[model samples]
Target: MDTNETTATTLQTKQHFEVLDGLRGVAALAVVTFHFMEWVYTDSSKNFIGHGFLAVDFFFCLSGFVIGYAYDDRISKMGILNFLVSRIIRLHPLVVAGSILGLLAFLFDPFGGHPELYSTGKIILTFFCSIFLIPLPVIADRGFNLFSFNAPAWSLFWEYIANIVYAFVLYRIGRSYLLLLTILSALAICYIGYRSGNLLGGWSGPTFWDGSVRISFSFLAGLLIYRSNWIIKNKLSFIGLSILLLLAFIMPSSKWNWLSEPLVVLFYFPILIALGAGATLTPVWKKICVFSGKISYPLYMTHYAVLWMFGNYYTSHKPGTTQLVLIVIAGLILLVGFAYLVMVIYDIPLRKYLSNKRNERLAKQKAGLI
Candidate 1:
């Protein structure tokens, strides 16, 4: 390829913020734990990881910073359609994979689930909508989640939306305008938190728009962190940062969620992102951090499939305290292993194939232009 042609291709092989990647994995683990506890505890106040849902906010904020860092400069050269296809290739394969797992779990959930109640037409539509990231919350058995088959896919839907908006609107704006938007989004988050009690909307049909505001602020804050050179060089290292991130998840829930949730999302997470981007990674932790980051997304997307099954099993069997403890511990280990397998067997290979096609298509387009 010529110089111009090469410049037009994707530049995603750049080095990552390894510490941030590790924190993401930590947060993903917290989310899975939270999902498990929510089924057993029902009451947030009793759940140790009551605030685990905030991990999604952290993901959004991290996305903003990473997206800006990765694409803000190169997007102009690669163009919007190519940028989006690159995102789809990176993200959608798992979306499809997760949806399929969820569908299977829903149908064959030997523990529970009444799939026979829904017609074939409804089930088919739900599956297709999930693959396309369309919001369809009609499955009452599944808490009417926006994507019943794979509930966590709800955030991925907003993530796709944010990517499109960034390609068109976010990248071109000056830092001042970006800061202004971030502030406005922060205000919305506070209002939503105060109105509802916590930053845990956007996964269901009724609270769908609630997710929009949740992502809006966190993503903007993250993007601003990158554009404004907000990196905070620190010596806490990945271990210390992981502890700090976990505190937010394990925090006690209370009537104070309205105040505390927004504060964490609006301030604590952005600060952590900055610190994570700059924190040192010890040689001992390097491989661990890399593995954590690589497995984070797959863990986040795929764990929910088992979560539905776990919920049914929990309700049907009502395992004793000892059994519940063992089940959850084993569940965490097995889920992590499953996520690793999916990453290797399904996600990585598919993304590699799709990315190759994307490069070839770009090359052909470049030749046509020439």
Candidate 2:
């Protein structure tokens, strides 16, 4: 293979690692605990589990970095249309499947007849908005909220929007300018927090934007790390991962998890660095990391529903310790099962097809066959 061909091949290898998958498992489990623990145990009991939502932040960083690393070159070369098509193929199928499940969930009222829970109007709105991967406009008076149909779908909206922003705005800017834009984005988030009177825009500033700031910044960091070819090639991913874990442990006790914001941002830097450096590292850590990464998405998407199921059961039956332990164990089993289904039936096939298509198209373009 020529130099360019060899480079592409290497990148493909990075894309296929098990560590990223393992991280997915970890992220998903965190979300599960975040959602269900409160139901099984009181808030005081949930002290250990309450922070599961932060896993989404980790996910955002991972998504941004991984997507950027995977697609920056193609996006830079092929333009947004190609990028959108690829994204749609990669993300939309599962999204549609999830939406259908959400609709069924709403109709059945799996969350319960808290008539205040979901509205038909909000359900319809969330379905379409989520379908298009856009944030539905907030209709505060309507009782139905972004958490209406599929609460998790909201994040996907941010993910898609961030992808669009990257393609049109960040990716085109020179690397130095991209770094500047990232800093500005983080500051923008903080400013929005102050103005909205909530660090996460409590009820003001659009919900979609709630996580966009972090997503954009972390993603840009990933791209920069990749372009620089710095830590990954130097066997520093282990160091980076260590620092991130240490920071997460130490950073949360401050006022309001006040340190959480910056600490998370700090934590992701090393993760992106490590992932970008995937090519050169053969650390034993690679095995564990990749496993978590692969299941992360399914773990993420399915965990909420799993938690909800457990909560529903617990609320009605009020089981004891054995049952609760069984519930947790069952939830983990369910997550694994669901992740396998998603990976085998949904994620893997679709990803392979889209990638293969991209490769074939690139080959044809090289040969002027188009």
Candidate 3:
């Protein structure tokens, strides 16, 4: 009702960085392709898009930048509980859907060869845990990794952790202290990469610390980018930037150049986000950016379930290279379609419902109608 309230509301709903949104979509697609390549090659070293896993790093950076942009100042108005609830509403719908799909896949293909995982009890436990976006411990006999239902959900678990850190810790810290934390995280990422020869082991039991380092560094880098308001006012197109991102992700890792992944996460991605934030887009490009960003999270969250089912069939059939290419192309199309469907039918609607409920509750509270 007042000027301050009006200003806060405007900041909350400000227009996003279109190029960054499109880039997020680009990274998500690369991740899907990367998973397919993993299925085809079966050897991590031989996969063409071996660096695609870095897309998760990219997502972390983007998330940090966006969260800072959207919430760094507004946290005073919204409070930590409101911010956490907002994040849950934004992210948890697709998580539940992905877990349900994983459960169904496990049911229909109960004998997909992992005998320990076929038990109904484990499947139900996994489903329930996944609904809450909780990462389960890896039970080797049950084929359970960090997240049994959806493997990629491990990253989301870490993302939520980062969000918590942001609200309670990072957001309140002064810029100098935040920079110190970021530097320390970067050093840790470099150390981990140097030891492992690549930024690879973040998704499973043995390397959960690696995952923490990866998210912490990149997410802080993103926050720094936002806080510094770094930007490049060049005429860089989203298309060009998107292509560059694809190349970055698909680039092969070299044993001789073990520092590449860490360098990209520590330095390159933050620059990319800054440039993306600064760049301008045409009307058509803006539409593409909106569409791509809309589908990015859904695609990331849901595609793994489809891959789980397809991986079994592909392994048994052992298709030739040509057939594999076609299958991959078809799979990409199907993934896009399926992600769009989930976005339309579930994600958007559920978020709207939750958002409305929250608003109504807030209004009632204001009117002393608790």
TM-score for each prediction?
Answer: 0.97, 0.75, 0.94
* Candidate 3 Cα lDDT to native: 0.84
Model 2 misplaced regions, further than 4 Å: 1-10, 13-21, 38-46, 109-111, 114-125, 137-147, 189-208, 232-254, 267-291, 350-370
Model 1, C-alpha of 85: deviation from truth (Å): 0.5
lDDT for 41 in candidate 3 is 79
Q: Which stretches of candidate 3 lie over 4 Å from their true place?
A: 2-13, 110-117, 139-143
**Candidate 3 — which pairs collide?**
none
Please tell me which model should have the higher lDDT, number 1 or number 3. Answer: 1
Alpha carbon lDDT of residue 192, candidate 2?
Answer: 51
Per-residue lDDT of candidate 2, residues 27-142 (tens digit): 57656655666676564223455455555566666676667677766665566787777777777766766665555554554544343555767657766875665555444421
| Local distance difference test values of all predictions, in order | 0.91, 0.59, 0.84
Q: Write the per-residue lDDT of candidate 3 for residues 129-210, one digit (tens) a residue.
A: 8888767764453245677778888899999999999989999998888899999999898899888888877787778788
Error of 1 at 1 (Å): 4.3
